[model samples]
Target: MYSFSTRSSFIATPHESMAELWSAISAALPVTEAEFPLDFSEKVEPSVVDVLKRCRQQLYTRSGRWRQNAQIILDLSWEKLNTGTWRDVDKEWRCLYSYGCLFKVAALCCDDASPATVQEAIRTCDLGLLMGAAIMDNILQTIVRILQNEIGKRHSNEEDPSDGVSAKKMKVDCVSVPVVKQALAVPRIHCPSLESFKKDYLDPQKSVILEGIIDHWPAFKNHPWSIEYLQTVAGCRTVPVEVGSRYTDEEWSQTLLTVNEFIDRYIVVKDASSLGYLAQHQLFDQVPELKDDICIPDYCCLGEGDEDDITINAWFGPGGTVSPLHQDPQQNFLAQVVGRKYIRLYSPEDTEKLYPHQLQLLHNTSQVEVESPDVVRFPEFVKAPYLECVLQPGEVLFIPVKHWHYVRSLELSFSVSFWWS
Candidate 1:
């Protein structure tokens, strides 16, 4: 079952901030504690301490091996099922089954890919799902116990709020407000509009950015490059590039050059799609080491709240292309693989200090002439606690959402990264 879908047309406007949209949506569906219901039982509840302890014991000790083994079995089953038809089996399976393949593969890979891998993998999948269910059950039991304790407290407090309250009361009884679990039977936050995430994540019409490889193997084909007088941070030098003509349309289409052609032209944007069509049987295992410095982890489909997650983005020099200060929407692990990048970080509290726009269309804020930052436009920016990090090959940085940042590459560089919420 091959899966394919054409992308919708939606150009991202960096200038538009989520502030107004969030405010409007929230106003339309005002959440109130009064609307949040709680269901407490009359009987005293069991202590959560014991239940949590049990959950931890089961999760950490009893269930680990079974779950791991189950994952291994599933992987083998999948490989055997598809081996005949799929050449690039794993990648193609990914396109066809999406996360469904992940659940089975991870189960099989939980253990070594053994000979009886397929059957073992299916068995493991069942065990893993069962283990997961058991863990969830324990969690729910704990929640119910806590709720019961709260209800008992409320019953004992008929006379006076202060008189019935005791310091030794169960932690759950400390709740003066209602919980969603009590009222709705389920506790969850659903952001349905998050489905349209990719629509807003980037310039929709813009080509999906990738970390492309051009010259690989026969290493002599590409010249070794370095920049002198590079600013060093943590024993690495930063190469800054200043490419004018803000994000050209030509670059998005990859119309001007192929990645290999771009490499010869002294530029590269990572994407196999724009490169010459690769045959089903073709495999270039010997690509010039693009990231001799950094290591990128595998990718994952981050859940709901992070639907608008940014994947990987990279651009080679024609220096001085300033990426305006903006925070990635989810937790990000950024690595500087080939060249150096100067990064400035602002804490969440510093959003105001940086004078981030309230509109979603604005790409963070207009470039601050950092050398002589215009205090008039961003008066609050003066108070922002700015930290500088120069990423070189091999170093990775974890950046949380709402943490404002800006990056500038010093020279022609290549990099790879992974992100998940």
Candidate 2:
């Protein structure tokens, strides 16, 4: 449940409604608690099981609306999560908090299904998914599906927008940033045999721009990944978006928004308060229809791992959004489906010169901003040899494992990255 969402119909099937979903989720509490071996925090005052039962009892016997008890439960759980150093909280306590949100969802379900109701339900489900342990996957997914179904119904009969047919495609362009200066251009190869690519590039771990490879992707031809197309297909789906110019900024934060909201704020008008990126997400899993537009690069077989081992993430955002100089553990094929990005790379051989962060979490990232390094602060960074390029549509950049890279979009951008050992 934590890792995969099967098309599997469960033995204990869950129905889709606030009330029905609450019952289904409440019923699964015992089984979920049983599945986990009391691994984290073996002792607790009001155990997760105790909390769930008490909350449920309160719901059953409430003199007033369920909100009285439910709201109290929600407030306490919400406070518990906020009061502590979040990572130190017991996993079981997180699960208990999710039950509190479930009661609230059930209470909301007892009311009419208005836009506000649906939005509140979505917020509860998203919060539970983010903070709770994987104990209640089916319950959360059921609520999400129901909310999505409601959203879909609202737009089911609406025709495409008036300007839908002539929606603008992202421009394929380049910018001359300082980081890309005084660097060798990445070598380009046109559809070399997999054997040649591996022997010449992969084994030596060289960065290369691969061409004539992804041109055949349905997203570019038969089913263009136009703003209009994506809005039509995935607008209703809720997704986590990074709200800032870059992830490394102090102001950088995340929130949940539907695809339509993202497009409207960041894509269509470019008028958002800050940059919004639907970055590094497994979008294919959530909106499977979008998955059919592109195929995995065959070169991934060189990882010598099964296809299932690959990690695919979607990077969709407006121009000027930056990925500060960082290194990924696995080899990556960064495929540009729409728009363009100015990319700069450094060898792991120059790791010391790059001045990596001292913190464990940011150790993989360079302290120097590749775009505009402070020569005085990180003097050695100027000595690092690097390669740079402006990746175009239908092009893929083969990034060897641990090669430090920095990327910034030149226009509205959508790229898919496939990582493998």
Candidate 3:
């Protein structure tokens, strides 16, 4: 009912209005009292379900014009207040909906060792925080309603809903339909089907050259893209550098000397498009096995590692060189040894909130810039929930793909990743 719009055959009924919808939600899923608190003096936190109840209570009184504002305030507060990090709260919300029930709120109950125990932390929270989370959640919910309505309207207008160009039938391309669908379906979470990818393209013992990997480093002292891009935005780009080698330490030192000399010379950004040797396409043509398994054009299998089902590769640059929000194809034990990057993650259940492009084959959405999103262009994006993480040298994130992600390097950065299917 919430997704229905006049353009589609489905019309908005009494049950779909904000007030009626809230009432149904309340009746169908009553809040469970947070029986315990983290501290004896404080009460246990209210479940998000309970929080929604309060929002609904207030929602019944507001004018239709103020409906959107009420939702936004609840959503923002939900993300920011109880969780400390808005990301965690967002994750919780999506998980609640995705699992098709609010019972998952039990996951947030308190543990003495942890101050932010699920129920206690939220229960004990002050009025300011409670109100804040409530407001934010409300906003997010309203935005989702709008986007869902638009998608339903489009899907309903289709001439052949059954034999249409849905996600199942889409082809991979420069603007991958699959990627787009995944991003939109769940803006927050990314769910890479590891089992499927492995059953199809599990390669062992892939190899890559030392210099070849460094060649993609955007933060390299001489990287032209770093200079050009930064010049256009910030006048300068200063990123830290660290070097290690599979070879002995002495060999690594010798390589560093060579690298330092190159840095002193000039900043040259190799055009990824022009550099055929730098890409996997040329190699795949030589080794056809690679062509079938390659997920994205930029993602390549460099060599098989010594471990079990471990594959080493240069993810190179993104397809857009800047990934739109989407998950990867495998469980990525990503290592960023060189350069720096910012990554934002969303859990699988956060799909509805993310408004992912809703096609199976594509893994990205049309939305860009997650924080302070552009409400006009990608209105659906405003409702997409996410958790952000930044990675530096020697840091690794065990990212479960299909868990939505957005990434950008602070400079020309180079990282090697091991993906297991």
Candidate 4:
């Protein structure tokens, strides 16, 4: 059912210049092609024609309301769906959003590859991804990759790069939390036998740190995931960022930002009011190039599914970012890639003692603050007794389903987690 064939160079023509890239992209478009069917015998929809016309005339004016126009159309499109959710919008609207981005792309390409211009173009494509549908034969992916890869190439030219892609930039090196109840540390197992792991830890529903196994991943060797490499490849892309010390805080909020913007604002700034975290994001689907660097552990095969069935997420942020005591539905392997994290995990049987939130939205999250416990409010929390581990790079911490865990970063951190039922 599957086959593979190899080809030489993908680009038979010269697309070395940004203009050339733009030209190739433009030619790929048939000037009058319709994005959707008209239902009647009409050659193209009026909306399609309107969008094409506006994109063509964009160069004539520097003052443009690109998002303004898209938003207007988006509002009308949502009405057709009986619900206003953007995720549930119609395909026609998606095509319209795509055209809107096409207009912005053309406008941006008019300028040379100044860092500002390329960055803006990259941001525009990300906007399209946020709003647009999978129309235009992945035009947004095409142009953005063209721009991103070009920039990455430029960055590669300037650095004496290493297999060491790490975030060694956080001001705080080792954040020590006072161990409550004389620490019961998670045991370290060096690639244990499947039977041993299942009997000793898995069957007993205990946490363990897997060591001396994941070091062979490309992310640890040839193509390490350093801040520099991440900036070069995905800095332009947009992702949801958590702005606060932790999600459990009253002032916490989520916002969309370019990866570079998150780095500059929260990771690089000397002082800031709150921490910014790129947490629990399915980054691999948006940027498949990054997925190639890490390999799924063979341990997952012990379960019923393989890599395709597992859910992988990325956690990247500055030191001091905390994940309040929480439990997930599936088993997890939280792999540290860049820096260190102090984790304290409790058994599922201790759920009643942990004081989980009653709210439906945060039911899985425990209310007892792991660091500064309120003794009078949550006295039973001290009785629950958790195991602590300082998860370092190259280590994988196994957390069984329904296990309560609190995690805090010790440095500028980048971690990948895989969850499987």
Q: Whole-model Cα lDDT per candidate? A: 0.35, 0.74, 0.35, 0.73
Q: List where candidate 1 sits over 4 angstroms from the true fold.
A: 1-256, 264-310, 363-367
Model 3, span 41-68: residue lDDT tens? 1122355445444433433332232333
How many clashes does each candidate structure show, in the order listed? 43, 0, 71, 1
Residue 168 error, candidate 3, Å: 49
- Candidate 1 per-residue lDDT, tens place, 137-249, comes to 22222222222233334445553545311312211111112121332121112221323323533213111112222223121134332221111100011112222423222
Where does candidate 4 have its weakest 10-residue lDDT segment?
1-10
Task: Give the Å shift of residue 133 in candidate 4.
Answer: 4.9
Order of candidates by TM-score, top first?
A: 4, 2, 1, 3
lDDT of 4 by residue, 231-267 (tens): 7668878888899988989999999898877887787
- Summing lDDT over every window of 10 consecutive residues in candidate 3, give the lowest-scoring window: 35-44
Candidate 2 residue pairs that clash: none
* Cα distance off (Å), candidate 2, residue 372: 4.0
TM-score of 4: 0.78
Per-residue accuracy of model 2 over 98-173 as CA lDDT, tens digit each: 6666777756754446667776777776667666654445466566666666666776666555554246443333
Kindly report which residue stretches of model 3 are placed more than 4 angstroms away from their true locations once superposed. Answer: 1-308, 316-321, 358-366
